[model samples]
Target chain A: MTQVVALSGGIGGAKLALGLQHILPPGELTVAVNTGDDFEHLGLSISPDIDTVLYTLAGLANPELSWGRAGDSWNFMAEIERLGGENWYRLGDKDLALHIERTRRLNAGEKLTGITADFARHFGVLGRVVPMSNDLVRTMVITDEGTLDFQHYFVERRCEPVVKGFAYAGAADARLPAQLQEDLQDPSLQAIVICPSNPWLSIAPILEIPAWREALLEVTAPVIAVSPLVNGQAVKGPITKIMSELQLELSSASIARFYEGIIDGFVIDKSEAHVAPEIAVATHVTGTPMKTPVDKQRLAREVLEFARSFGKL
Target chain B: MTQVVALSGGIGGAKLALGLQHILPPGELTVAVNTGDDFEHLGLSISPDIDTVLYTLAGLANPELSWGRAGDSWNFMAEIERLGGENWYRLGDKDLALHIERTRRLNAGEKLTGITADFARHFGVLGRVVPMSNDLVRTMVITDEGTLDFQHYFVERRCEPVVKGFAYAGAADARLPAQLQEDLQDPSLQAIVICPSNPWLSIAPILEIPAWREALLEVTAPVIAVSPLVNGQAVKGPITKIMSELQLELSSASIARFYEGIIDGFVIDKSEAHVAPEIAVATHVTGTPMKTPVDKQRLAREVLEFARSFGKL
Candidate 1:
């Protein structure tokens, strides 16, 4: 009966969201998606992270990619290619429609948080979906090569560039959505699960918002973070690589250290269970290899069960 | 070689532009395209008339549709559909690249005319293509149902709406591109030919620019208009249907009467040779059905030959 808030980014986070969606009652779960990776492409405002979470929750996500609509066509992108535009991003025709509608609504003066809420409601999604911020904030990776936009670093350039650090460009000006702020104050807000998303990239931006960290400090619920990195490697994406590039120890201990004072518990992959005793905070180990929907749900349920034990705290 | 300017909209006008391009020496022809049909769709500023003329001139127009790029693909549009976006306008993937790039550049502060000129130049088009006005102007249809945007009437609804009147919403404030105004004043500018495009919907918008009629009147060169309606029928599109809906006669005589003193010569299709004599204007009969590249060139040659006969008039 506890209302759970899951902070998420794109793929890795979406897996956890799908898992949470499976165990939690529809209205009891709220997934707050990162918008720092959102940018305008072909005049359409595209929220990569928000879309990934939406698609995964809607059961329309590509099974292999864990993003975009399954069975999506690329006719629109083919037309774009013929016109000599950027063909690198690979916008599926169906996916382009969402971007178009999102852009249309956004340009018409609708806040992105409201638009995402409406989109989630329209897609028959039972759980609440919220954007991290309504303001325009872009995640930029400060690499040895140069400062690059998140999509450029993640999608276009394939994260090959060495990350020196990352900056959430507009986080200083962003404010937590009113509902998100209110939910943090709710007595029923029993848990805040930071999905095993990339530390510096995904969770960092959410925490970077000027009031976001302060608001999380205000919540009475235990703040738990799941480690995206385990056994000296990332379960997915550039988390471990970025961690190493930033000269941090690439281990569950390092992830805990990264979130040190802010979190009450750290969830690591069962593969890294040996290192659990070394973590400075309370630690829980689970089978976090989310390769399947079943894997995602199992990991999510295990995390929830672990958090419930902390009700004694 | 006498320099000539032709005012045009989509298919029918592209045909005359093709004809004029073939006969005129390099730089002798300037095709001023209608921009009133332009509107922002999915955040991209789409100029239908400008693109149609550009594609037709670039030798990349789809032969079947007589608009968009030749051999165009639809991967992008397919993707859009998969995402549950509007699939009404089939923006070919290849063709979409141009719109996307143009929209990007436009948003970056490039003028519509400059962006179009760059596209034309890059495509190796020799004839100068100028937008009738640099300003944003949209044509709206006041129908029995309601006032609808041009694309809504033309594409989405497939021209099924009953129109009461048409309004060029921004024409009263639109200024003719300075280059075009200077062209009108050039002594070497020998003739002005209005291509056989839809009079009420296409040509009327260009003419509606408050200073346009005066500019046309001040020009010493002969102003000629080609009849889109031949033997009481249009070569393509809703010209006849729309004309009839607005309670106007669908005939070459009506077209001639429509241009009365504004034109010195009226080019009628050979099929409507009988009606040419009724109007008190210099009229010529010619082959105007431009179906192929050769047809476009040949028509351009004939129109030029007819205009050359009145040189220095």
Candidate 2:
């Protein structure tokens, strides 16, 4: 089986990652998740993207919320509010266990990668899930409201602030986890898939690591990116809003251009297939909206087959 | 109205504290809870005794469990067990809010006394509740199984270890909280009630503070202790087993003798009133088993009236 590494962010990326996990053979998929959104809340280390990927792959994600655990209880949050603690970021009772355990392990001098892998195994996830780096790389949103932490801007403020730019604080000191390096350098590596998550908020943090971009440029495997934009709007979250705020055109062509130099192929929604000619890379049009498990697997299969067309499989 | 102070531990102490809260006028009772059993668990600062007192006084305590909040959910604990995290402490989802909020405040440089008082106020507790000291005063049980922390000895091990002796790890440096000092020195102070918690496990931690004993001896207010034992057996917990292991007679007289010169009066169960001759202080016999809210109030009235009989009121 050819090994594939997927770069993922949160909900949108987790949907595609889950799809990839279903189609690939056991242990064939490695998801390098963005930890830029990780932050300490109430003394607990919370890795939002990593948790979303884990929950999605393990089939424990809440169907309605698109995050958190299924049948989750809100007893903890209710009591926190009563105690006058900050409750803008909703934490489910079951989901809180992950944050508490992760924080405990981290405080005890355990590496984030090892703790994530242990959690993945315990959750019975078939594919490997690893953080992009062990060191802190906080994603700071330089908004009109001032510099805000990723979760503060996204969850607490509800993405209300106008975007100026993003700064990955501590990225200069960050190094790619050894597992991700091994996956990237594997002899049986097929293609690197950038899942349909926000390019600037999700994928950019992983690519911002100096060594990561260099490694991707050096690898023989074709680098493929799936468009988060489906016509001119994001399937979910604030990609379209951010693009408009940054004065960038909300089109698949723009997304493909964002990954211009490194990407060899791009996947976009079939409705916007006419823009394929404008993209310099080889483009494949497919149904990209992942509303169900079948939709996820279908899109995943199409993306993989598109990567294979480059003759690198 | 006579102002009074109570020294408390966990469940057993909490029951009597709840009774006192119900009987006394608002702001007339101040509980100085032992912090020796407090420990960091899952990266949260958990003050078990303080929480129990708060919950009981606020009428939010679980009637059956005698600890934690009523109608609590166990989703946190269940998920923690699934993740292979420590599950011995059994933190309920609702109860966890207190620990999380308390830890957050403490980490942000807020004093534990202020946080606890705020929490009590939030919970609508009428009487004031304060920790014995702001400093860490961990209770260490030196048993045949070696030195174990208080919670480890009680909750994790189920009090199975053979007792040898006990030590307060940080008692030498601990001082009475300023609020407690003020309450003790108040001109309107009538009596100090020692709740019917284990002398070895609960009350000992608070009393072990050198300043606490010295302050009690210097105060003019009568000091009254309620016996935890009834018919040579503790109503709850391992008080009897610990007493026998420590080579002491399992009798109410032993508990009264344990307090010796510090207590001016002692309250015992009507069945054990015959042992009054062995105790030098004034003894009052009452129905001390509190199984209902009415029973708590009745015991509270009895204990207060007993204190009044010393002519200090």
Candidate 3:
């Protein structure tokens, strides 16, 4: 009867979320997705991280790729091109429909939390998928190349810019979504898992909400973080590149240091077992490459077992 | 050297605009498009009237239809269906691109006039396609069913609702686009042609602007109007049905009366020749079935000839 809450962004975060979903009961796992990348494109409210996790968990995500739906068509993007629009973000026809619906619902004054809940129900996702906040919080990456929007730095520019730092626009006043706050305060809550998402770009924005961070710290549950970087290289995204730009060692050790005062435990990939000694909190190693459903389930079970060993229940 | 300003909406309006484009010199024809039907769908600021006129003037309009581009694909709408978005608006992929770019520019604080100017220049439209006003003036149809947003009545519901009347939201504060007013006041201006678009739906909204009607009356140049209704039926859109539901006679003669104080001359289709005696203004018959490029040019020439017959110039 353990209630597990997992924080995630897109891609690497979704991998670990899939694992958690496999091991947790239907109502046990609540996922809080980053909304920093949400922007109005082509008049659609596109929450890239939420969609990626939703697609991944529904078993509809492209098996080879971390983002977008599998077997999706480019008919819509091609047509957008014919109309002389920028197609750098690579929205598939099926994906475009979700964005359109989300945009429509959002414009009609529905909260992002409610929209996410409806979308999860529609997609038949067994676990809850919640946006970090209902407020607009765009991640602004201040790079040596100049201040760039998150998508511009990641998708449009292909993450080639040298990062100076990052700022969460609107995070100063952003409150945790009611659903997320309620989940954090639930009596059944036993653990919080920080998934393998980019520390600064993804998870930091969610944590920046004062109430969100305060609620996590106030909770009695053990907070654990899984490594996105293994053996000095990130599994996906610009985590390692950003780490180097910020003059930090790109390893599980650095990952632990990034969340030093926040997390109670650090989970590293088996390949980076040597760096376990340098990580401060209680650490463990297990199969962390969540390539298949079986791998996801196995990792989920391992994380749960490791949490139980901390003598909470 | 005559500066001709043609006020238009969709389809039939585009046809007359194409004709004007053929007859007028570059920069001589300023086409004021209706923005009453404009609404944000999927976060795209869609100016349907402006796009129709732009595509028509550029020779990119569908030959068989007066709206949208030729060979347009529904990939965007199709994908929107997959994501469970509103499919009623039926945005083609290429059409969505126009909306996306327009929305992007709009969000960036660019004026609707400048965005449209860029779109017109990009599409190779020789005539200027100016929005009636930079402000958002939405047309709301007060129908027997309910008050419906312009697109909700026109596109989504297929204009089936019984019409009571209409009102332009935001018209009280809407001023003429500065450049449009400047062009209208130019000494080279000779005549203003109101294209064969729906009077209540298209033209009424433009006139509803606080000082717009005054401006139209102040200009001494003969203001001519083309009838949308012929033989008691509208060539396109909901003009005939709307007229009948509002207790107005569903004919070209009634159309002239509806525009009574505003116009000095009226152009009717050959099909409406029998009803010429019923019209208040001086009326003439011309081929108004603008189903092709030739039809547009021919109609434009006829309207110009009718204007010249006044003998003031």
**DockQ leader:** 2
* Clash pairs, model 2 backbone: none
Model 3 residue B7 distance off true place after TM-score fit, in angstroms: 1.9
Query: What is the C-alpha lDDT profile of model 2 across B149-176, one tens digit per residue?
Result: 9999999999999999999988888898
Q: Taking the candidates one at a time, how many backbone clashes does each contain?
A: 26, 0, 3
Off by over 4 Å in 2: none
Better of 1 and 3 by lDDT: 3
Candidate with top lDDT is: 2
Consecutive 10-residue window with the lowest summed lDDT within model 3 chain B: B75-84
TM-score of 2: 0.98
Candidate 3: pairs in clash: A43-B42, A43-B43, A43-B44
Ranking of all predicted structures according to TM-score, beginning with the best and ending with the worst: 2, 1, 3
TM-score of 3: 0.86
- State the TM-score of the second chain for every model: 0.96, 0.97, 0.96
Judged by DockQ cut-offs, is candidate 1 incorrect, acceptable, medium or high?
acceptable
Model 2, chain B only, scores a TM-score of: 0.97
